[model samples]
Target: MMSKNTQADRNPPADKTAGQTKPRGKGKKYLVGLPITVWLVLIIIVPILIMFATSFYKKVGSNIEPIFNFGNYAKFFTDSIYIPIFFKTLLLALAVSISSIVLGYPLAYLVSRKVKRFRNQLYMLILVPLWVSYLVRIVAWRAILGRGGVLNTLLLDLHLIKEPISLFIYNPFAIFIVLTHISLPFVFISIFTSLEKIPKNLINAAADLGANGPRTLKEIIIPLSMPGVLSGFTMAFVTALGDYIIPQQLGGPNGLMFGNLIVSQFGYAYNWPLGAALGFIMFGIAVLILTLSNKASASEGYLE
Candidate 1:
């Protein structure tokens, strides 16, 4: 009976379809991803490929010649004017990023740790500015900061100034203020998310060890939250660097950024190849920033 059972088990009752079917989830995932994959390829990957390819070509009169050369990047390096603007843009972006962290961190802490009941309300308020049109906001800032506008009128009414001041709009200071304000909410959201995920037991453990508020924050909270802060900085810096509309709206010739140079190449200058080259360089820089930040975060995590 045991030998018969063993032989029957080894022979196995086989339905004709026993190992013929494929896994079920693979088909579903492929179908779900098909549209998105196509969209990404057409809209993103294809354009990037075209841009990179175009960057290698030469623009002659109204036409682009298929002459592969590094002249575009070379021109950017050789020109002293654009080179200084690039450095200045880097500095400006850094300043905006740092300012966002400084301004957003306390606000994030207040919402996440202090305001427990109405934290959602606080976050919504932080994001309220995003609901407004960016162009509209810039226009509004122009009105508020313009000569003989809201600020000047208020100052005049308060008898604080002799006449309208042109210090608020059409300058580097205005661009910095606008960019920092625009970036603040994003920075706050990132920090608040990180701060919220911190283990309460760690804080309590430190407190039990006679560590005061500031000391505990310095040693525990800051170390844990540094990842979020770096992320916020990198995002803010990238946004600031890529901005062209704000600079055009509020910046004079003297306050122009690297974006304007790229714009000029594409626009009236009619040099699409050079514009593509500049864009690729910007992309490379952004990728480098993300790579460095990721490496640092990984190293910090390992050390901790």
Candidate 2:
């Protein structure tokens, strides 16, 4: 019996089907992911590739010439108007992102940490505007900011002014306000999610250790919630950066952004190559921002 057991240990029975078949779960996963992969390639990768290819082409007398050149990229650096408008747009986008964070953080903290009974109601209120049509919201803001609109009417009723003021609409300031309002909800949601993810035990532990509320927040909460802050900031920055519609409607002459230039190149100018190049530049900036944000979040370790 000992000799037989020793032989069995040295040489186990060989399974006939060993290594002949693959795991069903792995094959199933690949099969399931195939459609999504194809869809992504079709919608995203293909368009980007086409755009990249087009960026190398040339435009000649209202027709796109298939000529390959670096003129499109060169023009961005050579043109006097493009660089200034791009810098201005960058400043505006930065301002919008900062404003969203400032306005959203406190509200997010209040709702996520302080509120209990009416939490859902307040959350819904914050999110409700998102369900409305973006164009409708812009139009509504127009009505509110127009010459004889609600703001001026209110001031008139309160006897605070003699007539309606044109101070509110068709300006960069109006564009800023509209962009902030649009971005605030997204920022709030992000911060609130981050706050919610904090383990209650951590707070309790801090309290037990005699750390006060402010100290606890400073020492523990803020550090943990940074990933969400970065995420929200990136979202707001990108949203404001690519916005042409808001600038067109509210920005007036001074509101011309980099997006407007890109739009014109594609639209009336019939310069697809230039437009593609400009779009790729903005796309590169966005990708860089996203990468930096991801790295920052990774450093926070809360994201892990």
Using lDDT as the measure, the top candidate is 2
Residue by residue across 1-304, what tens digits does model 1's lDDT show? Answer: 2222323433433433565565468789699889999999999999999999999889998988989999988888898877888889988999999999999999988998889787798799999999999999998888889996899999999999998998888899989999998899889888887788666866787789899999888877777777788888888999999898899999865679989888988867889999999888888888899899878766543211
In terms of lDDT, the poorest run of 10 residues in model 1 is 1-10
> Clash number for model 2?
0
Q: Per-model C-alpha lDDT, please?
A: 0.84, 0.88
Top-scoring candidate (TM-score): 2
RMSD of each: 11.4, 10.4
TM-score to native of every candidate shown: 0.87, 0.90
Across residues 100-163, which tens digit of lDDT does each residue of candidate 2 receive?
9999999999999999899999999999999998889899999999898899999999999998
Residue pairs clashing, model 2: none
Q: Give lDDT: candidate 1, residue 178.
A: 93
Candidate 1: deviation at residue 249, Å?
0.3
